[model samples]
Target: MYHVVVALDEDADRARRQSRAVADLPQAAREVRATLLHVFTDGEGASATEVGAVRRASDVLNNAGVDVEVIERSGEPAATVLDVADRVDADCICVGGRRRSPAGKAIFGSVSQSVILQADRPVLVTGGFEE
Candidate 1:
């Protein structure tokens, strides 16, 4: 079976998009095992909203008859995601992307960009989302 690690953020829309992307993957029913991962950079545990979003994502995969696991990690977003991917031996990493101006990106780094550039495994990015 193919293992997929989906990086879930606090943004509900983005998190849902990431889950939808995983659901849309080929062989999702028969060959996909998904882990919904939320990384808390502050070392704090998941907030109520975060846990709800994770549970919602988990439900999506579970309803599709896919084995799902929800994991929470504490560390830098990109680094922690990579660490989890390595530990899980993920076949691909799924993340949501946001459009950012050059100036904005210069000021704030992007976790999706970092994962795409630095990941040893394949990374699938979902973007162009409304809301």
Candidate 2:
């Protein structure tokens, strides 16, 4: 089975886009498995599976007939995502990216950018809808 790690954040739209990207994969139901990961920063103690964004993504994947798992971690978002992906031996890492100027990205330190640059395996970045 092809495995994908989908890194999700608080944005519902971003989660939808990321989940849809995975659900749209070829023969997704028969061949793909998706792990939904959410990293809680600043020592926030919350259930990842209960998070709205995660739930929405899960619903989408479930509707598409893809096998799904939810994982929660606490730490820097990018680092945590990479660590979990490695632990799970994911075939691909998926993340949602918002449109940002070079200066904006440089100043804001985008998690998606960091994941893309640091990941050893394939990374699928889904762009958010035009704002």
- RMSD values for the candidates in order, in angstroms, are 2.0, 1.1
Which prediction has the highest TM-score against the true structure? 2
**lDDT by candidate, in order shown:** 0.85, 0.94
Question: How far does residue 76 in candidate 1 sit from its true spot (Å)?
Answer: 0.4
Residue 25 C-alpha lDDT in model 2: 98
Whole-model lDDT for model 2 versus the true structure? 0.94
Model 2 bad stretches (over 4 Å) = 129-131
Give the CA lDDT, 0 to 100, for residue 58 in model 1: 80
Q: Local error of candidate 2 at 98, Å?
A: 0.4
Error of 1 at 23 (Å): 1.0
Q: Which 10 consecutive residues of model 1 have the lowest summed lDDT?
A: 42-51
Off by over 4 Å in 1: 47-50
Cα error, residue 56 of model 1, in Å, equals 2.4
Provide the global lDDT of candidate 1 against the true structure: 0.85
Best by lDDT: 2
- TM-score computed on alpha carbons, candidate 1: 0.91
lDDT of model 2, residue 22: 100
TM-score of each: 0.91, 0.96
